[model samples]
Target chain A: MRWRVIGLETHDAYINMALDEAISEGIRTGSSPPTIRFYNWEPGAVSIGYFQGIRDEVNLEVCRELGVDCIRRWTGGGAVYHDSGGELTYSVIAPAGVFPKNIIESYRLICGWIIRGLEILGIEAEFRPVNDILVKDKKISGSAQTRRGGILLQHGTLLYGLDLKTMFSVLNVSRQKITDKMIKSAEERVTCVLMHREAGREEVYEALLKAFTEDKDYGFGAWNRDELVRARELAEKKYKSEEWTFLR
Target chain B: MITHSSRKVKEGKIVKVEVDCEDVIKKLRITGDFFLHPEDVLDDIEKTMVGLKKDVSFETLVIKINDIVKNNDARMIGISPESIAEVLREALK
Candidate 1:
């Protein structure tokens, strides 16, 4: 099967999540091919899982003060703070039948591409069960997946940099003041590409793009008009609405 | 009263429960980092908690959740019916 590969593009939180959902819908109806896209979040953002409580996971006041956008994801997972230049996010949307029916096995298969990508940078990482990629026991990446209407959509982030202070500020880790010790504690459990090797963001993206496309029949592609139209609609109507954001 | 509790289950996921109740659960909300496929099954899980006595047994809660989960063929990753039940019971307390 041929796969569509879209290179890195920048968008806000709402558009990023909306595009994934939109692509899933397209793939479900056979209007679009299986797709693998990499993207960046601009102005930064904090995204909580679908079932997550916004108040429990994000500090909206802090986010607004910091000029960061906050939104909920369509998939289930922990909350993530996507810094503009701190991470590279990727999404794989295709028919559910194309992958293993077992969730863990499928996560392992898709996350393997990440492990290979990191390997190209000389950073050896391992996939932790459910949905995490760790380097030396510290998390370097995380993903979430949701299968619907015969389509499976999995999107995740690969940490390129660390901004624990801003990340902690936006996320509701605690009500206490941000402290060096707190950041230090998080550093022990989290990691990024910069922590492992010296490489530019473009180089890392290229490495990932290569690994993801390896052994697969894929070609560079772009979203069609239908996908763009649907994504914008979902971004404005569903993702940005108070009802969806506060669904919890 | 709105009672709330959260638990970091053994499987490394957090499960939070918010309940409004007197003698029986009036409303319940389950939220956290856990993954539940066919996510709408959450509605059924929350619905099952409603009208349950404040003193409902953990076993009973798990059974109620398991029935819905099994019937829907839903998959709960990083969490289980028992874990959700425990947090719900804790919130009621």
Candidate 2:
């Protein structure tokens, strides 16, 4: 099956999420092809799982001070701090039938591409079940998946660099002191690509693009006019609204 | 009053439950990093919890949730009915 491969692009948090939802709608209606895309958040952002209580997971004061966007995802997962220069995000949307029926099996299949990309960079990584990619037992990437109306949407983040201070400040880690011990403990569990190699973000993106498209029928593509319009509307009406952001 | 409890399940996800109850459960909210396909199944599960006795037995909660899962053909990863039941039990305490 032919897939649309969108190269790494940058957008604010709302528009980024809106585009994914829009594409999913398009795919369900047979207007869009199966797609795999890479992107970066601008001004950075903090995203919480659909079921999470945002006030419990995000430090809104810190986010406002730093001008970071905080939004609740349509998918369930832990809160994530997406740093513009420190992370790379990818999404795959296709009919559920194209992938394994078992959820973990599907994660392994999609996460395998990330593992392959890490290998290409000479960085060995493994897929930790339920959506995580780890290098030497330290997490380097995390993903979340949600299936709606027969189209399965899986999106995740690949850390390229570390910014523990900012990440912690924005992620409601206020109950604990932000000290050396905290950073040390976090560094032990979380990691990024730069920690393993010196590849620039552009090089990493190319490697990931190659790994994701390898042996698959896909081509570089762009969003259609209708998708852009829909995304803009969703961004303004849904993602940017208080009702959705504050939803638990 | 609202009672809350949270735990990191051995299955590898954080499960946090907040329940509003006096005698019968008036409200229940389950939040976590766990995965649930066709995610709205969670809403259904929470809805089922409403009107249940606050002192609902662990086994009863499991049966209630499992029935909903089977009915909806829902799939959960990094979490299970037993784990959610355990959290709900703790919140009741």
Which numbered prediction scores highest in DockQ against the true structure?
1
* Candidate 1 chain B: worst-modelled 10 consecutive residues by lDDT: B6-15
Off by over 4 Å in 2: A173-184
Local distance difference test values of all predictions, in order: 0.92, 0.90
Q: DockQ (C-alpha) of model 1?
A: 0.62
Instruction: Put down candidate 2 lDDT per residue, A1-248, tens digits, no spaces.
Output: 99999999999999999999999999999888899999999989999988788988999999999999998898888889999999999999999899998888998999999999988899999998989899987889999999999999999999999999999899875222224224545547789999999999998998899999999999889999989999999999999999999878
DockQ of each: 0.62, 0.56
Candidate of highest lDDT: 1
**Model 1, A1-248: lDDT tens per residue?**
99999999999998999999999999878788899999999989999998999998999999989999989999999899999999999999999999999999999999999999999999999999989999998899999999988899999999999999999888886322124224445547789999889899999999999999999999999999999999999999999999999999
**Candidate 1 structure lDDT:** 0.92
Candidate 2, DockQ score (0 to 1): 0.56
Model 2 over residues B2-92: C-alpha lDDT tens digits? Answer: 9998877768777889999998999989987788887899999999999998789999999999999999999888889999999999999
